[model samples]
Target: MDKINLSVTIAVITMFISLFLSFFLVTVKTEHKLSNRLFAFFLILNAIDISVNLGYFFDIPLNARVFISSIFFLQLPAFYLYVLSVCYADFKLKPKHLIHVSTFLIANLILLPRFYTVSLASKISFLKKSSSMLEIQFNHVLVHIQIILYLIAAFMILRKAKKIYLENYAGASMESLNWLFQFTVALSTFYFIALLKNIFKFTEYPDISESLKIGLFLFELIIIFWYLYKALNNPGLFRNIDSRLKLVADIVSEDKNSAQLIDSEKEYNEDLLKLKSYMMEKRPFLNPSLTIQDVSKDLKIPVRDLSVLINHKLEQHFYDFVNTYRIENAMDILRDVTKSKVTVLEILYEVGFNSKSSFNTAFKKHTGNTPTSYRKSL
Candidate 1:
């Protein structure tokens, strides 16, 4: 048996953390009840899957290890479902939920002959072969296809949800499912890295696969931190919001600071002025959930016009334009001696940024300094 490494020890700890949190969510009276259950399942599967991987470092029996291979296939499905449940407050899984997980089910059916039908020694051998079994070959293609399709679907769900949320969900306390968006992006990046690792191994790209193990380590950190952060700060994101979220309920108090309205020239130029004025006056950028539609409603301008103003005239997309304003706002606050007592995180929220990464990126992009250093300079 291989000696246990420090990395494996840390991973085991993270695995238990996920397990503990999953149990909490499973038992809690959460907001998004259905979504929370689904997310907890995601966490449980992931924790156990990692546990099984770590098992090889210890004294795990072969039969038990082989039996647990099925959990890996279930992970893709569980992750996809979690994303769906969180993004769609109204989402519920029915008997049809099986279809989303059908690949894992099918994988298990096909893999059964090797993992179960064989002796312990033979089962281990079968698992080691690169492409000797039909099931193994099918798994490669299936996993790649499944990942691409599900990632696209997940991103589409987020895109649509953001659009709809900004348009109608004024009282949601959160403008966008910001944490969930980061979660999706992080999930996608994780898969991409894993796929890359597979490609390197298949292609026998020298020591690339060994280097890619670092990628896997980074992915573990991403999942652990992302899950813990969201689980701590915004438990409601995982709650089964259902019809209870009163989509337009008493417009969550708009920033007392008020949103500015802009004016532009005729045609596209007119859009430019209108968007600029609205941006300046309304400061809609301060709303992390602020979207083109949200700005449209506030400015009484069409979404397309606002898009054109940002895309063509401003030479920036809506996201960048908004971040520009947010970064500038952060700078103003950071430079003020009166606000010196405010923490960086508090200022991030004050300027409509929900995440440190987003705040730091925008801050560094515009000011060429991180939030802390920028403030220190002033």
Candidate 2:
């Protein structure tokens, strides 16, 4: 086999092994409905990617090349969909999404005839020789379009998912978001390399092709392993450890006398105080959905202790505490004569309220007046 074929063979093997392990881990550990479906979809995409590499390795027939190219064109959108599903459980696939998928499919169908007419060897030779400015520009345009679409989808879901996690599962949510952000960065790097490869092709700098391929392969392997490690080692990777500890303390407090639980409670309280102080400094409460769990993770405090401190010492529920800060910040914004001209909705969002309704309700509860009235009074 040629050097390129040999490298492709090794890359294909690595991807196949990673794919197999990923599937096994997902099947064994995934419990959430959306996560399971996303994993399944991820597996399918990986399968297609592997098949494309395999077909190329063997110098498959021109018809096989056409099939593989179609699959390749579909892979990016599938990957973005998988990312969305993993990050957002409530994300529903819509008709508009289907339309987007169909567009890529139809475009591939239109090009398939041309793809099949070219011999496999001749196609490879053409790819190596072609430096046509028009073709390069066309490919670059397609690459940018894919990148834009993927980014829009990934970022939209990430923003919503981050809020949901913070509000609903605060203590563990920070860790989850941290990991998610890292994953996104890694994926983005891979896409960037792909973009660069297309640019190099357009610019007739074919020497970078091998380097791009290697980088792409390495990045994919890293992503697959990172995901598999999280899946297998901590299926509940997103759960807050501090919160679980606090729950234990709470249950024990209920069964024991105040005196008996005093020392333990005191220790827990001290830790919780440290955590709260850290969060106060960070001011994550600026996020309307920020919760006790997120604060705990940010401060590295046990979730249970954070819960206990908020519930017992502060005498406020988690959501109430978060909204209190959000409202307080909103008040400051409302009172600023220079910036007070900003709309109520703008102030609401500026202070971390996700919706105008929540901001209005929280402001009314905190200050006994609507934001507009408060602004006018100011």
Candidate 3:
């Protein structure tokens, strides 16, 4: 296909998929209602982005194209908020969230008199010399600024959320967050390449700029398809972590100079022994959806202290700590001559793992053998 035809075809496909997913996400019944709606808004914004490009391909009127392009300012904000909502269960759309779009509002106000209120002929002439206009250049620079700032914020939230998930819950939570992590990294990479493409457009090589645009279009199409496949396969993947939960490491660093730190250090060995005894006797890891809060409640220990005990004192994440006991439990089962006929799948569930892949991974990590191999070795 010709370059224009190929770009148009890709844009059309991307726009439709985004719209479809936006509708589905909004209408679908899920526990993560806030996250779903925010994600839906992000998808709709993506669809709008595709529509702007498609308008250029079809030679839409300058006035309409200019108006449509204004929405470009909202895309990064929507995506950043979506990331926040997906990561934090307590996330809400407070009025303060409007601050994120201050740039968009400022951009519109800057254009109100210079472009938006101008006559059609003036608007045409303005765009003709837009390459040299200070306001136009400022807006372009502002877009790159938004991309960098929002991408950094989104990544920070995802990183904190992953650490919180690891230190609290065990089961499919990590898998859900892994999908978001991969998606964030992939989207950030796309933005980086698109940034490079935009920079290349200003160079003396028009042919290279055109090739980069085509490559970006193809990359965007592939990303959208990958998202669709992952979303379908992991429909219940929107697990959330409490935003208020602080990591044990963060807590320690913040309190390093406090008297409480000295006291906590004194109790470290006692707390470690107590935690180990509880794990051995209670076998709480047998619960597939176990969380650190459950243990805290059962042991009458403060959640923060319990987190320090498992994560800081034990020198392992709550996930790895719990999985270690689970693997040990599975080992006992594997060594049982009486249970020799039991399948590896059955044994994994019996020992509290929810998925064969995770069970196998944890097993190998702890035992240096797959469950089947461990069983056969015995």
Highest TM-score: give the candidate number. 3
Backbone N/Cα/C clashes per model: 17, 10, 0
Task: Write the residue-wise lDDT of candidate 1 on 210-286 in tens digits.
Answer: 46655576577668776777677765444222333222212222211344223335566666677788788988877
Error of 1 at 248 (Å): 16
Give the C-alpha miss distance for residue 215 in model 2, angstroms: 2.1
lDDT value, candidate 2, whole model: 0.63
Q: Which 10 consecutive positions of candidate 1 have the poorest summed lDDT?
A: 247-256
Candidate 2 segments exceeding 4 Å error: 1-6, 92-96, 112-140, 202-204, 238-378
TM-score per candidate, in order? 0.61, 0.56, 0.91
Q: Is candidate 1 or candidate 2 better by lDDT?
A: 1
Reference-based TM-score, model 3: 0.91
lDDT of 1: 0.68
Every model: Cα RMSD to truth: 8.9, 17.1, 2.3
Ten-residue region with minimum lDDT total, candidate 3: 257-266
Q: Count backbone clashes in candidate 2.
A: 10
**217-252, model 3: which lDDT tens digit per residue?**
788778878877877888877778889999888888
What is the RMSD, in Å, between candidate 2 and the native fold over all Cα?
Answer: 17.1
Q: After superposition, how far is residue 162 of candidate 1 from its true place, in Å?
A: 1.4
